[model samples]
Target chain A: MNSRLIIANIIRWLILLLFQILILRNMSFYNMATPFVYVLFLLLLPFGIPNILLYLIAFGTGLTLDSFYDTLGVHTSACVALAFVRILFISVTVRDGSDEPEPTLGNMGFKWFLLYAVLCIFSHHITLFFLETFRLTEINYTLLRCALSSILTLFVVILIEFVFYNRKVR
Target chain B: MRNLWIFISRYNAFFFFIIFFTAGIILTVRNNIYQRSVTFNSTNQVVGDVYKNLNVLKKYINLGAVNDSLAAENAKLKTEILSIKNIDTTKETVVKDSAGIPQYTYLPARVIKNSITNRNNFITINKGKADGLSAGMPVISPIKGVVGYIQDVSEHLATIRSLLHKETYISVSIKKNNAVGSLIWGEGNFDYRKAQIKDIPNHFKLSLKDTVITSGFSSFPQGVLVGTVSNTGISAGENFKTIEINLFNDFSTLQYVYVIKDKYAQEQKELEAKLTNEQ
Candidate 1:
């Protein structure tokens, strides 16, 4: 990526991280579902940004969140898992030699972006809640937390996507 | 050997993923102990400062609710003070002087960060070791209701494991009969407003809305309000009754709290340690 694009990405990462920890961290539905909008950073990272770089970035983002949430590596594990899911989903759906644009609602189209987001986010939430609870007896509640949080996160992500419709970045 | 090298090169990303994922798992496993050191949490210097500053802005929005709660507390304390003064201040003063420094001192602090949605919830406050606060200092909402105790302390911040957490248990007694039980979390932990009390003997009468207060056995000073008994059932153990209670503190809107400093905590701890060592 060009230096200008790199700077833009860094700024976006910081903004999303702050927004997630400061605002969304405090917003929970009946102490069950919390919208994790910070994952947008990983979801929209420039395509073909080397898998290693993507995972490392995801780990850092999750660690920052984990510090604020006092959740230790729970978010880190989930973020790394989400990074893997992101690469796998993109590879399966987007042809390897095809023109690559950043994954956003405007560029990827609604249907494709929705599928990509749901698949990736659910992977993150499921990993997060399951690792957090870490018990088989509470599987039902854990799954409920994952599903509710994933839906809330996806809704917020889409709402933000619509509000800030990005032009196709060259 | 060439094919093996090419295979490793091709899957280098997966190897990196495995390495980081393993580290994450290790951290998660050791997280309970990791919290002892205040490095990787909201109490960390940078994160604590951010929360402290952000609280300045958020406090404005919450002023109305804070006012209402404080007003109620004021009214209650007025009547309580009137009654205490009428009883015999001179005699109480004599007793208090003989007792040395007050057993528990209250250190006022602001709640910079709180969480209620997790199975294990923690609250971060702006007071820390510099203010003579330390781990195991009992924290309570104003008007002295049970909240939690300090779990870890840094220079200017401390994290409290709230009663809403799965592991938090406080010794409590029914006000009517003085029957003792342990207050614990879960049985709908998502409903942060509720907690469960177990080990009350089945023979004791437990009615709905019976007031529960701290029994002085635990770290808390005696008589701090816990909650009212909301439900009672047969505990798995034959002799014990499972009781549920409604917590008073709405952790969602919790802004300020008092961390209790016990003058006798260190001395008592040393005595207990010596007893264990003797055994």
Candidate 2:
């Protein structure tokens, strides 16, 4: 909520959105395992950010991606769901009204961050792939996409954090 | 009232989440093309401009190869045009200008972004309204048969709802017998290669490698190769048989597609609308 934080987030948003839309948007491995690194923006949002603001930011981020992908509402819904789960997971694990540090790998340690990312990424991917497919008959295929994409996204997100944020934090 | 207000305020985040979630569902279910066109689709100026720049750079890098291919395609198209220029003069129902020239025109465009992984995949091309492209115009790959319909257009960019999309259904037929069926892509990109053709008659006796092409009954021109019949199933108790086709367009690496401009489309659409309204 400081000027520097706002500036940093705006820059982060632009970089992540560009990378996601331009690079990863078309990077699918045999129709499976598309890495959506933009979710890292939502994942790294500071812990003490207001819940309503988090939801709005998530919606905004997802909606921006929705337009580019031409999958209206699919990403929007997934981002909102991810935001909800992020809030829930943080509340359950972290203390109420704690310091507003971001839940990054460097700050929260590797193990804790991975679990948090798994839950939120799965939530978003499941909501996303299912909404995009919108059918029960292809549940298996949808589930496979969710699992594969979530794993890929998780890997990319972690790698990005290690490369980008580790040096900054140190 | 005070207690109720407190409880609601306590769960305000949940309420907001519900509002956004419902909005997303509405968009997903309705697949609101008009709404998206007016708003955030890449067709919009900002996103379109960015994509245009990125594509320019990518095209710049691939310019040498593209030039060679363009020359090859140019020679091929010129020859093809020469062959098709002399369509039988006696052919009835062909749309012609006052000077007897065919009305359908083809505009080549480069694909800036293509998605084969998503269930509702779309391809964005470098041409848009400025290039005389519009919604409902048929897009076909130069090598592959049908690509998709123009879903939205901006000044410099347009998004195509490709054959890989779940909502895109194309009317097609078996080339051998002209038996028609509907082609749809909802089987989860089994390999980003397969699509299902529904409503084929059980007695059609569809064999493997039976060529599937655009059924002229629809907006797309007739006899355009859709794919070859790869799999056929005769399920029990069902009057209609379903078959799977391997799409000719390798969406995984789709680079260029042509948007077909049919001069009679407006006239045909209006006439059909009138007929439907009357019925």
Highest DockQ scorer: 2
Docking class of 1: acceptable
Clashing pairs in 1: none
User: How does the DockQ of candidate 2 come out?
Assistant: 0.29
Clashes of each: 0, 0
Complex DockQ per candidate: 0.24, 0.29
Interface RMSD, all candidates in order, equals 3.9, 4.5
Candidate 1 ranges with C-alpha deviation above 4 Å: A1-170, B1-43, B89-100, B235-237
RMSD of 2: 21.2
Cα lDDT for residue B49, model 1? 81
TM-score against truth, every candidate: 0.52, 0.49
In candidate 1 the C-alpha lDDT for residue A115 amounts to 98
Q: Across residues B161-251, which tens digit of lDDT does each residue of candidate 2 receive?
A: 9988878889999998877889998764456788999888877778899899999777788878789989877666788878898888778
In model 1, what is the error at residue B45, expressed in angstroms?
A: 2.7
Tens-digit lDDT track of model 1 for A1-170: 57766887899999999898888888999978988999999999988689889988999998999999888999999999999889888878988766654788988889999999999999999989888876567898999999999999999999999998876766
Candidate 2 wrong stretches, greater than 4 Å:
A1-170, B1-46, B56-95
